[model samples]
Target chain A: MAHIHLGEGSFPLWALVLWTLLGVGLISAVVYRVRKGGIKTHQIALAGIAAAASFAIFQLNIPVWGGIHMNLTGLVGILAGPLLGALIALVVNIFSAALGHGAVGLLGANTLVNASEAIVAYYAFKTLIGMDWDVFPASASAATLGLSAGAFLMGAIIVVSGVNGSALPRGDLTIAVAGLVGLNLFAAFLAAGYWGFTVTGGAMPWAKRSAKALQRGVQEGGGALVELGRGIVVAGPIRKGGLMVEFGALVLVLGVLGIGLYVYVDRYGGFEDGERPAR
Target chain B: MTVTTLSNHVPDPRLVTAFAEQRDGPLHRVNPWTKIGIVGALVLAVTVFDRLALLAGLYGAVLVVYGLAGLPYRRLAGWYTLPLLFIVSVAGPLTFLEPGTPIGGTLPTPLGELSVTWAGIVLFAELSCRSLTVVTFALTASMTTKYTDVAYMLGRLLPRPIDQIALLTYRFTFVMLETLEDLVKAALSRGANFSEFWSNKRLYARILGMTMLSAIEQSERLVKSMEARGYNGDITLYGDVSRPPIHELFVVIGSYVAVVGYAAVAVYGVRQ
Candidate 1:
């Protein structure tokens, strides 16, 4: 089979072209929106949210205690506007590509997959918000719809691109699906919580407090390990700082976790391709 | 494609001008769209299949383009040589995995499951050629087209929403960079050199945290100002210009012809 390897998966040329065009179209629209003041501040905030979501999706995963792991760019998009979210996913995908997560050619498709979540989220939120419900209730309801819709969109895109059915074997599909679900839920919850907190208090209390504590903890010079840990903690919640740190952390975690999954899947998961499974 | 070894400090302006030359005498008068079409067609023709032929065409075409563009010097010498690096990075390991004829003695690798092959080398060369061709065409397009013209062309090609975004992004790129710089400077004044803060995670966090806070505030102000002016989902273009030039037709035709001819010849050669 001719597989074009990218950030983490293989895709066909059609997917690449389709996704690139979509990204171009979406990003262009967002730019127009920014210029025209169709919620410009929201767009930048959405961009930040998307970046954060990309980081959360890629970096922070707890071992499911099984062979499966998680990733979550879609959930982030749900909170951010589709266009803005897609743009953020593109930025993250590009950054990831630089680090060899996928092939450079696959940047477009990867961005498209991640952005689908944000787009779905935007519509979902719009629909829920029009209900005129209270902010918290609306946010929660919207988040659920956004997350599920985002996952469904991802699944649909994957299936259409032949990624789920043919690109990956039946066994790997389960792992990927499971990972996607976990990532979506986690991202949606975090995004909702952040959105809720931001609207109510102008800041996330937990993240803010965590940032303060982390700063205090790292006031004195420490060992390399301590410093690294401290960097992660302090960097994890300072808005933009957290986003970059979180992204880097996610890439490292995913890489290590991906390798682990490959080994476990090879031994127990039983890859159908017969060739060495992609990490 | 010709890697001009830069011994001198300054780039040779004449070579760059020569390299940037478009479709010769008559084509010079052609429309930008036609020029774009020709370049696009040529690039597409070479890229579809067979990296070797693509590379060869790219090398030849780029050399001619470069000569015409008057660019004989490479700005970033290392970047231009990246094709070779990519080939080695991919092909070096692939050779061992393929299990082909061991032309000579064994070479050591970090991985125990692989060995080298002549096939791998050929594959590497082919891949290198593809990359080189892409770089050449990209460079040619960039050299020949102005940023504004490219933006204008892209705007015309895309939907109204997207086209407007391209123009906005292009216009705002410098503004964003300037904003980023000022923010960075402010951070620096407050004992925040991000490079030094690497040893201190808290400091790193503080810098980014503070920067984002300020960025958000500034963006909010900017957004408010724009909204106050009754900005909506549309941006006004500087002038009403959308007509294609008469000479552009020839340029577009020539481009398609060259691309189609190259692709046809290469495909035929490959099949035979």
Candidate 2:
């Protein structure tokens, strides 16, 4: 779910051009970096996995109040690295918008945000991992940081991009944009929470513990109730050509497949997971 | 084993299949990149949406485009509804939240004073319509064109490695989806209920966690299968991506020209 849905005419022609150029430029750089590294065999497989995972993870919905979704750019970045992550973000953005997962017009801006998130998160996670931090802590911090940056990037696009005068007066548009920024932050926080828990809380003892907590939640009328209620309200429409369910479900599935494909692609080249590359 | 039974429950992967195809509509006949250019040019022209009449006209144009494409309204309704909701959520709140020409009267609340403004409501309508305009244009291009065509277009447009990434992403995306389906089925077989999974977040997470672990393990196994099949770094599309037929190309170009003419008039002549 897109936090900010900037409609048409929000940004001027030059601004849209600028953003597209910026996005294209960044993607080119990432691609250049990938090729220059002389990765011939398993690296391509890893990149594919990275793209698949990024797209899939971006589709998971937490169903929190009014429903929030996690893009998992941070996690994808960590798994796939910067070059692949950047390309993946652009592809996922195209798929999401086309498939009706996010706003279509905002694809360029959103791609920029995703690219930035992947790059930022990749570096941050790698730095932490290099410092010998545990995977859990590194993932959490990177996720929070990446997603927070993403939230603000969305805000910046919302603020600077479109024409507000046509809607309300300039003053009111400013306040509306500001409110959207706040909304983005809040949504990002919830998504980050979902992600942090998924990796850290999903492990053996933690998984068992979390499952109990979830059971209690289901029984106690918490987020579980929210999902059930949302499902009831939306499921009927969802079945009748609603791409939301299809999107979220497929993306997650693709994510799993991406990882599996990556493993396969790598192994096909006689590369082991542990021996992947120094990244 | 319950595995056989559980597999029966997996929903048909329709959305992907739906997207991977090109419908035989007037619009679908155009090469994806040309339509993409048309969509892009229109999206860039969104600045003219400042006027209500122009905004409505653009929307009407999208409806006409849909009609010309021979696409079904019911098939596209779901896409339309989301932007409507987005408008309400985003623009609706502006009426009460932003200070402007009040509609009726102000209300006193614990949070503070709240007034639904005329200008704010209008602004919401305007912005929401604007969002609708761009979304519709993008959706039309996406719905009418094939995903493979778009990816190939992207590959041709972008530099080398990026093109490779685009192609690989397309190929691997389906593989990943199939893998995910199997995982979900396996999860379902092992005492996980679909209704219960949806109802409970933590349990879903627990299952997701298992999937995540399996994802790591599966990657390893997949490499073996891929290696056996002679895996390489390159991705190959099965067939050549066709260009738009001349008539379709002309139609798309003519539309883009009209859009540009309208936008130019709106931005320079009328607005000035």
Tell me, by lDDT, which candidate is best: 2
**Least lDDT summed over 10 consecutive residues: which range in candidate 2 chain A?**
A217-226
How much lDDT does candidate 1 score?
A: 0.43
Residue-level lDDT of model 2, residues B91-208, one tens digit each, is 6666576545677778999978889876666666666666666666666676666766766676676566656666665665565555655656676678765543235655555544
Error of 2 at A93 (Å): 0.7
For candidate 1, lDDT tens digit of each residue in B1-272?
Answer: 33232212212222233433533432233355655565455435434444455556666765676556543345524234333443443344444444345567776667453445665555445545544544554444444544445556655664544443344434443333344345456656887644432243343333333433343344346557656776574555543334556666665777677666654574333244
Worst 10 residues of 1 chain A by lDDT: A218-227
TM-score for each prediction?
0.50, 0.72
Off by over 4 Å in 1: A1-79, A87-110, A113-279, B1-32, B51-54, B70-72, B78-92, B107-113, B183-215, B240-248, B261-272
Query: For model 1, what is the error of residue A113's alpha carbon versus the real structure, in angstroms, after optimal superposition?
Result: 4.6
Give candidate 2's whole-model lDDT: 0.56
Per-candidate count of clashing residue pairs (backbone under 3 Å):
34, 15
Q: Write the per-residue lDDT of candidate 1 for residues A1-279, one digit (tens) a residue.
A: 001221122233335455555545545444443333333433443344335323322321122221111233333443344544555566555433332233345455555555565555444544555565543454345545555655555544444443311223444444444444455556556444443334433243334543332222122101011113235422112233333444355446544654554455346533355542222
